[model samples]
Target: MKINSMYPPGASGGIRAYASATVDGCLGIRGIKVVEGGRDGLFV
Candidate 1:
């Protein structure tokens, strides 16, 4: 799996960034957001 990540302008706090992933040269997934969690840590 391949992943890309970024922090958009004005993004802050819990929801702070965005990402995308590609699998086996497929068109793959996009616009996956990143958020901060209390205990479970970050999730896709």
Candidate 2:
């Protein structure tokens, strides 16, 4: 599986970022996770 991250060009209303993942170079999935509170974190 491979994963990549992408940041919004500017403000995204409430979304901060996005990410995508692919498995076996065939199927793929994308989404975001919201952390209520944290100092440092990773999206994917």
Candidate 3:
């Protein structure tokens, strides 16, 4: 899988950022969320 883009949120709301990625160059995924996690700190 490869990341297409990662954009930070405009405001803080637990979510750290937004992301997009491709898998195996044959599939596409969009609007993947990245957020805060307990203990782990960051969630993706």
Candidate 4:
């Protein structure tokens, strides 16, 4: 997975940012929520 675009949220609270993403370079996702927490660190 790769982040195609990322920008900080206009408001603060649970979500930290909004983003678009791709899997193996294909445009397969959009409006994905990015948040903190998880053993690995970040949860998409």
TM-score of each: 0.62, 0.40, 0.81, 0.58
Task: Give the alpha carbon lDDT tens digit for every residue of 1-44 in model 1.
Answer: 78854656364668767878888878788888877787998876
Q: Give me the displacement of residue 28 in model 3, in angstroms.
A: 0.7
For residues 1-44, could you state the per-residue lDDT of candidate 4 as single tens digits?
A: 98878999877666779998889986678888878665666687
- Scored by lDDT, model 3 comes in at 0.90
Put down candidate 3 lDDT per residue, 1-44, tens digits, no spaces.
99999999989788889999999999999988898886889877
lDDT of 2 by residue, 1-44 (tens): 88765556355544555667788889887775433234665333
lDDT over C-alpha atoms for residue 11 of model 2: 57
RMSD of 4: 3.1
Off by over 4 Å in 2: 6-17, 34-44
For model 3, where is the 10-residue window of minimal lDDT?
35-44
What is the descending lDDT order?
3, 4, 1, 2
Ranked by TM-score, top first: 3, 1, 4, 2
| Clash number for each model | 0, 0, 0, 0
For candidate 1, give the lDDT of residue 43: 79
lDDT, candidate 1, equals 0.74
Which model, 1 or 4, shows the larger TM-score?
Answer: 1
Q: What lDDT does the true structure give each of the candidates?
A: 0.74, 0.59, 0.90, 0.80
List candidate 3 stretches off by more than 4 Å: none
